[model samples]
Target: MTRRVALGVTGAASAAVMSGCGSSEAGAGGNVKQPEISSPIDMAATQDVPVGGVIKANSGDVTVMISQPAEGTFKAFSSACTHQGCTVNAQNNNIVCPCHSSNFTIEDGSVTGGPAEEPLPQYPVKVDGGRIIVG
Candidate 1:
């Protein structure tokens, strides 16, 4: 009986740990109230990003690139490469896809380098308080 109870508890603990993996969204666990899922999800902090700098942020499951072109001016685009949907990274003044060297302008998501003909989809972004909110 003791061994059966120990196994049951161990299995429950393992299940709990596995369930929490690979998710950033707040969960409605028991008495805790989950945050409302709104259209404009709160993204990165404004102070962490500098003028002419870019940062990668997650809006739920979608990955977005947030750029500061000038002081108080911000822009965001889908980080997925237009060529093959691989996630792109911030490289200097351009967003580059390591998969195929596809480069896009930070100011606007226009493709500056080849292999990708279409530009990254830009997201409407605005600064509120110290956070950059994206929809």
Candidate 2:
């Protein structure tokens, strides 16, 4: 009976560790919440977004990545990684997810590499009088 109990406990511990190894959570036991945006959000001035650069913004419960690939052009996409729903936290020429190393293109949010199979969800955005509006 003692040997059986020890084996059972070891198996359970191993299963618990394995379960967390593939979790998509950004941080801390998969407790990260997906941000939600129900209404249009005004993010920042157009001038603040540099050409060939990107910016991350959170509005109303949703996190978004905005990119200006060139002059007079802007695009927006969800900051969540499609692979495991982890929030993307890093950006270079592409948006990056720290949780799984997924990289997405700044132009259209398409998966460039890593484990993500789909592109980041896109949101409609417009430049209104120097303000960046996303919905």
Candidate 3:
């Protein structure tokens, strides 16, 4: 009876390992992937968001930060992090997430430190009529 009980426990453990592996593959197979949102971005005012500046805009379930690292150069990126799907709070010329202490530069949304393995995704934008529109 002891031998049978031990075999059942080992089998259950193996099964659990396999199940965990399967879930991991789903994240790797591009299942959590987000498609590019192509829509008319409402004209958000451009207010001298200078070098190392960050602007937070919420649209639907998304948040965006329009950054200007240098004069006359602007870059917009998804405020969300690629690691744990947490929104990056841009402050003092850097993007920070308290959840894991991930830090990214506001200049280009590039990871500067911590556990983040990938950079933030960028969004396309056009400045017209003194407003920034992201696609």
Candidate 4:
């Protein structure tokens, strides 16, 4: 009986530890579906994205990250991380995946470090009347 109790306790402890190892954050579970945008998305005003900075826009079905590497020059990419299909949730000058710590450059979505072998998929973006439009 004592042996059986010890086994049960060990199993419960193992399950608890394993559960904590995975992220509960959205898009971090690897199975989370990436948002898909079929139509042009109005992301933000050109002035909202500072030079050398990035902004994330969610348009119901898709998430896009827009970055301005230089004044009046705008670029866009899918927010999904290339490492494990996790959506990037953090950013500074770089996009960061909260799942496995993958980091990507905002200039062209190139991988900087942390297990991502491919760059984030790029999208076309343009500015019209000071609004950033992405498709």
Task: Score every model by TM-score.
Answer: 0.69, 0.76, 0.68, 0.80
Provide backbone clash counts, one per model: 0, 2, 0, 1
Off by over 4 Å in 4: 1-11, 17-30
Candidate number with greatest TM-score: 4
Against the hidden true structure, what lDDT does model 3 obtain?
A: 0.68
Q: Write the per-residue lDDT of candidate 1 for residues 1-135, one digit (tens) a residue.
A: 699999999999999976654233332111212123348888889987779888877656656888998888999887777776666787776788776688998889899997989998888887899999987
* Whole-model lDDT per candidate: 0.75, 0.79, 0.68, 0.79
Ranking by lDDT, best first? 4, 2, 1, 3
RMSD of each: 11.0, 3.5, 6.6, 2.7
Better of 2 and 4 by lDDT: 4
Q: 3 or 4, which is superior by lDDT?
A: 4
Residues 21-98 of candidate 3: C-alpha lDDT, one tens digit per residue: 324232122123333567957536667466668777666755677887776677787666676665567667777754
Q: Which candidate achieves the best lDDT against the true structure?
A: 4
**Which regions of candidate 1 fall more than 4 Å away from where they truly are?**
1-38
- Among residues 3 or more apart in sequence or in different chains, the pairs in candidate 1 whose N, CA or C atoms overlap within 3 Å are none
